[model samples]
Target: MELLPTTIVAGPSLLTRASALDQVVGKLRAGKVYRREDLAYVSNAVDRHLREMVSGGALKRLAQGLYYAPKKSVYGTLPPDDQELLATFLRDKDFLVFSLSSYNTLGLGTSQLYNKTLVYNHKRHGIFSFGNRQFDCRVKPRFPKTLTPEFLLVDMVNNLDELAEDRNLVLQMVVRKLPGFDQAKLKRAVSNYGSAATRKSFARWQDG
Candidate 1:
């Protein structure tokens, strides 16, 4: 068989690129999410190096400046689910809280494991993917620092069914888990919800 040129034969420096790829993958495997700025801190060569590794199947791009290492499937295809990627991205962005808080606070519903994630943002709904599961962004109009935490707790309760299977279990768990939960605060937060279901849920939490 005819041989290609040495450059084409090597297809770029696999060994050197592999090392760079390993470093990136290591960070991700450690449960760390990275933005472009974070990668820039690692090396000036990150952009080109990352792109090369992505092309070489050493890395999977979640979105711009977000990535994950794919696990091998039975068929040998590397796949990472969307929720995993979004969680990584949210971890990096620092704008997300698990959806369980809502279920717990409102006595709404229950899930064996938490799947849905609530992300706080004012401008746009940030939705993106990593591998299989879908991620959704729900937008809020304004988030004041003082009220934001409470709002997060309240929003989760109001949308409890989005994350759980048994609403009563969720409520019981919240009441059991949260320390020093202010009944006044919970009542005030639920007041923001005019929905009868939310009010009823709040009553259940209070009675619990």
Candidate 2:
């Protein structure tokens, strides 16, 4: 029998690309979502590399500038959480905070998990979604200086039980963080609370 000549195909180039894709996938698997700018910062080839990975099924686009690895079948067809996605989108833009997120952080409100309810300085109109999560972006005119700082403190108080389950400790922490805060704005927020007793209690805390 006559021997046939075998052709050698290039493999190292493919391997190198696969290795880079693996690195990117590893980052995503570790819960790191890269923004386009971050990716650009990491490498000039990041965009092309990311596109290749996306085409090869190694990376899934959660949204523009957001991605994830689909190695585990857990996420189904849905994208990443909207808040997570929005946070990435607004990472460069200041004045974006989850409304309920701040409330949860402040140890003030009830324990209720909400979708991404972000408040930004722009006019309240931009709303979008990513995967199973919804981004309800609200624009606040006038860019009130008290909004972000005050709401963040209130959110800490709202999630006090989750923080330690010791109400006294939580209240103490809240009180401690209150000084140097905008007292008038804080009072207004307390007054806006639905319950008169709750408002009075918070007012006492504010005064104290």
Question: Who wins the lDDT comparison?
Answer: 2
Candidate 2 local lDDT, 1-208, one digit each (tens): 9999999876998877767766755555534455666656544379887898789776677676777655344755444543455556666344455555445545443355655565554643576655445566655443344445564554344434544345785566666767767877666555442145556567687566
Query: Could you report the Cα RMSD, in angstroms, for every candidate shown?
Result: 8.4, 9.6
Candidate 2: stretches off by over 4 Å: 5-7, 69-83, 92-125, 141-186, 190-208
TM-score of 2: 0.47
Q: Give the whole-model CA lDDT for all candidates, comma-separated.
A: 0.56, 0.58
What lDDT score is found at residue 96 in candidate 2?
A: 53
Cα error of candidate 2 at position 84, Å: 3.9
Worst 10 residues of 2 by lDDT: 155-164
Backbone clashes under 3 angstroms, per model: 13, 20
